[model samples]
Target: MSMIEVHHLPPGTRAGRARAWEELYATQVERATVTLGESETGPTLSSGTLGPIRLVRIEMDSGLLQRTAEEIGHVAEPAYSFLLQIAGQASFSHYGQDCVLGPGDMSLCNNAVPYSYTAHGPVELLLIRAGIGTIREHLPSPEQFCGRHLRAAEGLAEHAVGLSQSVFFQLAADLPEAVHNRVARNLLDALATAFAIGFDDLISSSAVLTGRHARVRLFIEENLRNPDLSPGFIATRLKVSSRYLRMIFAAGNETASAYVLRRRLEECARQMADPACAHLTITDIAFGWGFNSAPHFARSFRERFGEAPRVYRREKLAALATGGGALSAGATESV
Candidate 1:
């Protein structure tokens, strides 16, 4: 709960405007900077270490920009970390996996894994330096925080962005040491907790009983991908009652069975629409989509989509390829 904010002065004293960067005191300054013609110049070598986290936020100038980014790969390979590009883009190599990150884009990886990257566009890096060693010393496994990249979801970008600014504001602006340290600790904890909740929310949002029922839904969807997936199994896995799972889904215009069936149908439609899947029999398609029985699949498909699975796929694909007829009928028809 401590907060800090800093905006540096623009070096634009040309028109005789006041100096943009003002020393607030011994350890704080605020300014706004706007770069003109880029012959490339800046104190890009600057970096700082948070009490338990390595922290830095900087706009790159020519010297750092021109340097081959590959030479700096070692700086990235930590247990839990994310890099956000505010006004430019970067390309990164992580454990032999290459990903290009754009403005407002973020990249995350297990620090224990090998990583390297480069940016081609005007680069601004807003980096988050948090890891298992610093934050997750008590977790079941540090690796749980690693292995996948989490982006600032377009919907959650506003909240996601509050993080970088919070850190930058604190470091570059004034606050008591006691307050600063407390805020820093909270920032790290808040971010890690938010990330953990977000990851859970992500997995659960794809479930039938998502949102208020995130944990429940996550259990259901994760198990859904298994053929043996069922309400009983899902409830047990979630450590919740089957009646509770049923109640959660029932509030969302569905019973658990209906919701599962609908999701399975969507999956089946996707697989069926793939031209590569033509060789598979309808029964095979049904089972693959998680319908344990063919007749039940056919009946459910017809009830849900107003047509048999084969006819629906044929018309949908034809509409997609040739663009007319029953597919048009299906399009405007009721969901």
Candidate 2:
């Protein structure tokens, strides 16, 4: 959570300054070519890394950043850039959609796809990067939210932007690992809400089914600590057929059971990483999160995070103690 600052270029020739700017953009963001405007000042970037998420704040004169098809091929895995406009304006284009982003507005872009951003005069933005796995854990179909304007200054979108900005600029650098994980979770939840609102037309067209799906998810979240929270139990409690419950989850390419297991595991991981929960044994945390069988939780946790739960907790705690971040094990499909 420690911020690293990249200030203006050192006194040098114009060509040298341009090269320096290009290298900084490539490293801080994605592999892209930067076209600087007619100005002597270079952009200022402040960046921080929290686990799998990377946050960056950029302030610069008008310029263009282009990611070509070849650059897309070079990416090792799918990821996303959630951009929040802090000052001035910027335009973004990706996957055949284009939109202008003004202050207090936000948008998401796929890093594995060809995209470009052009700044109008001076602009400032906070960009949050997460692997596709992390994005999918929060947003079912993340791609649908890409390149669309998510306005702040009112409603849920405003809260999401404010949280993002606060995390980027105000997080105490020494927060516990659990706090960092929770902050990331809450931010993503807010973004998911805003993204859903961005799809008003789709929700309106399928209002009944969408309403049912929302109810199902809310029920699951509220009862996650209940070991009996199964698909059959959920269907019965919500007055929906098991077949219909499956159908609702199918729309998101996930099974109701899978979602439950994923969430439970996430909760267990959060507790395990928390120092306040250090009094609780790993098995206690698992059981509290509705994981009944120790062996089953072990296997599933390994598969999901690419490590045993105890090992993950140990490494996470150790990293936090030393003021460093640890990467999550696996990634999921693109948005």
Candidate 3:
């Protein structure tokens, strides 16, 4: 099948246009219910895929598109959809957060969760969807940014918005798969930088303890591959006492050690579910993500995920081979 396609309803009744768009969305994106006003015009969509990344541009009159919990369950894989407001305005609600986005603004949606978008008037939007593994590969704890409005005029976010617009414009062009893949990767990197910088700025301006917590979290995320990553080592590197480090996590109602272990296990789970890591053994994934003991890793994996590592990997692979694999609910939940 071709990697790109455009969809526009023929001159017809508003009802006809709504039905057409509903079907188009289900095929190109996930299953969504599109509703149009009686006097509104039809919607137009142009979509393209680059590796595991999907790019879409949509324009329409006042309307709404929603994906409910049931609809979310039907999705084949967990992903994150980044939305950029190209023109007009739209209201988005997800994860107990709501925001109205104007031209140049952006927002994120976790596809595994229920969400809705309402276009106030004539609106144009550019959206990019990437798999969970691909997203985690770039951003640390992406869920924190989901549902928050990202102003395009901000520091790195401005650059990210520009990059996203350029990428969307390039999606329809005839290009080699390798070129598309490279562009997609670069886009992810730019977005990750924007998110990281914004998050850092937010925490840096907070109280001293909060700032230290943020720094420690970033440090752990960056060093998850190091088998020696531990609370004591992190405290040493940050020039803080071990007790103080523990106190920071305690203030957040979690232990520093527990936080580190959870992050490492989550990273391991992500890599195990990714097809690119198929060549790596389960033990290798555990060790690479800071688990020093195979037996301990196995016990923890089962305790947290409710299954043995080998069994989990095998099931994921089998489901993937049949094109029906769905991301586990535990792995896809917002961090």
Candidate 4:
């Protein structure tokens, strides 16, 4: 799983940064904390599995609200920033567009667009970043969503809070898989969903689809050495719904089942090419890739590389014997 980093900054220094934000731009920034356990100690707190996004929490007193607004103006310059002000009151302006927010209100901002915002006193804020590259990957024109405002659904804010609490709680517990799976997937989905909707794209088409592919690719790469690996196992391990997993493959321009087989065949070829493995017979390579039956392995190997595994391995050895190459390939066509 991807890890999250949490940070704890001192109050006064944090307030100063918040005031700088207010003075610099039309927005004030607050001192913040690491929201997730993605990192140990760093500027970015995150989890490994969430991909490109980062989560954070911040707080500022009512006195520093305006003073910190200026700093936000700059923070908004590079990424799509979101703020869920869980408490307090504020009215914001994004190049003259106005939105009033109070406790439980969520706002979305794009740094590339100029905006001004004022909050009432100290409040709890949960913010998330949908990285520059991530937003662009979902849209051809990234600027379209820039410098805009967004309000969170009541349920959404509640859920975001729940996700934040759950991620931290889960990390501390370090519980068994049964306890963590649902919450873990939900946090990813919720955070990703929030960003997807904030950017005004099809939430289902974006985050869920992209995430599924990412999970699948991760599963594939991790099990490259496991000969018994298969699409069925991958889907099961992901806890994916059957129909949904297929759609993910479709979106990724692949057939889940076919891709796994091809990968295994490819891995076998790599092993065959190694001089250190030349002493091993071809059947040794086939079984190592999880092939159970001798004939089935040869037929599949031939189909994958357009030649029997024995022939391919023999050719390499032959070439080596003739001084064409140093180490020849080795494998047996028969078990």
Candidate 5:
């Protein structure tokens, strides 16, 4: 939650600055070959962790950085970096695509693959790194967006960059952890929207359907606690026909109602297994996720999870307490 201020490595000589810059990139950013065009003025970096995302602000002299295929194998963890060009221009090459981004432009860079960027001049950039798994859930075919310049002065990209700038410059370090997490989530949502809009024409129709299904799933998850949540409501809210909505969900081989019921039951089982919900009764937990009838909820939960609600909860919780359960983390549904 605390902002990490990485002071410019004591400015003295070009050699010292170059070494400092290398060290900073190796530690703060991903390890890559950094060629400094003007070694006298080393790059300045300020970084921090925002929940599951990491943010870094860098101002550096012109340079070229490369992450080669050989280097990628050594990467301990793979992530996607959303780079916003705030000043100067840069050219990026990745996935056989090349792009040039000027001020108020952005691009998504995949760290899992080889890529390179060369700055035309002194540059200031905001780089956000998040787990690929976390971002892939929201944006299908993330690879298609990589190395493509997105205009930050228009549409969702503008809003996303603006919000990120506000957090970088205006937000105080003392803000609560929850507030920082919320900001990070909002930023991701904006970026997802930007990518979705920017690549609309480039993606195939099936991809568009997948994207729509993802959005519908997100809507359902957000409104899961509402008893009145239904496919019709979702279609109206998303500005699509109920019939079209069913078609989208059908791509995943499930009806909208079935998906909703499955998700509700899964949510109930999740809460029942969570220690934080220990004080809540089985019926309370079931109703909390919009299950109207206790018996029906119990039957559905058992059918999905292979045990009675109370029994499953007790066994799962006990296993967790003893560190013996194969309780897998839930993955976001993908179409």
Candidate 6:
């Protein structure tokens, strides 16, 4: 099953609702100052994790939210948030740009910097937060696009918004982990495409490189179970020189070997924490995810997860049994 969380202020006094709004933003979204504009009704929030991505659905009355530079220091992991306005009207200010969004409008915001959002009235929003590294390869300079509202009724942007909304609504706590991860990846890809529509010339100029990079990533994902996966092997399979392959990955602030190792370790960790894999031995799980040596896998797993694989799996399973759901046993290290 996947992990999901729901929070609500209920029908309460204005003060109580304001308190709930503050807590919800601090914990679920990011550190921010939330002011209730109406102060008549409370807010409701439902959020869940889909692999590396986080989806949040918020329904609230008029409010003004601000995340100052001082608050950004409190964020341990920086991410990019894509918001789809489901109803009402709102304006966002970030990256020296201020834009108003109506229903069916989408906008991107970076959590690393200060931002402000003001809702004109009651609003409903569906937001997707993804690791910066996950989308950086596609949109090299996301700041330029941040705060620029895109009409969801036009072109690829519309399809992308629809895809994200459908996935968010259909996600369930009991869905297969693989399905959840795949859907997350798909949504990211769709968003990348949607964001690129605003910069057609830029995308056209880099189409070849972007296409190749995507192909390489797809190849790596498809063959993660191959113990012999390496930069040389991957380069050979893609018919590219090893040096060129390294250059491509380097441009994205990653090395081919490091990328392969990270993916393998991530796969092993996912399987280790999966409930269905409880019957498998730790060593078996490691090898199944392409690790050739148990000792090496254990060492790498500990380095990545801050604990041994066995310990992580046990703790995560225990947490699940107690209904204390977590996306991972430990916070994921930056890519």
* lDDT on C-alpha atoms for all candidate structures: 0.51, 0.75, 0.76, 0.52, 0.75, 0.75
Please list the residue runs of candidate 3 whose C-alpha ends up more than 4 Å from where it truly belongs after superposition.
1-3, 38-40, 201-335
For residues 184-302, what per-residue lDDT tens digits would candidate 2 score against the true structure?
A: 77777787777777677756656667667755765676677789999999999988899999988887788999999987886677657654456677788888878889889999999
Which stretches of model 6 miss by more than 4 angstroms? 1-3, 10-12, 201-335
* TM-score preference between candidates 1 and 6, better one: 6
Residue 124 of model 4: what lDDT?
58
Backbone clashes in model 6, listed as residue pairs: none
Q: Per-residue lDDT for 106-150 in model 6, tens only?
A: 888888765778788899888999888976865676655676778
Q: What is the lDDT of residue 92 in candidate 6?
A: 81
Q: State every prediction's TM-score relative to the real structure.
A: 0.41, 0.58, 0.60, 0.37, 0.59, 0.58
| lDDT (Cα, tens digit) per residue for candidate 5, span 23-138 | 78878888776666755765788888887788898888777777754566678888999988888988886543468888878898878666777788898888878998888866
Tell me the alpha-carbon RMSD of every candidate.
Answer: 16.2, 17.8, 14.2, 21.1, 17.8, 16.3
- Model 1: lDDT of residue 2: 27
How many residue pairs clash in model 4?
A: 50
lDDT of 6 at 255: 88
Off by over 4 Å in 2: 1-7, 172-178, 203-335
> What is the clash count for each candidate, in the order shown?
11, 2, 0, 50, 0, 0
- Candidate 4 structure lDDT: 0.52
Residue 334's lDDT in candidate 2: 13
The whole-model C-alpha lDDT of candidate 2 against the native structure comes to 0.75
lDDT of 4 by residue, 200-315 (tens): 45334676576556546545645644666776777788887778778877864678777766766765665575454777776787676666777887788788788877677767
Collision pairs in model 3:
none
> Of the pair 5 and 6, which is ahead by TM-score?
5
Q: Which 10-residue window in model 2 sums to the lowest lDDT?
A: 326-335
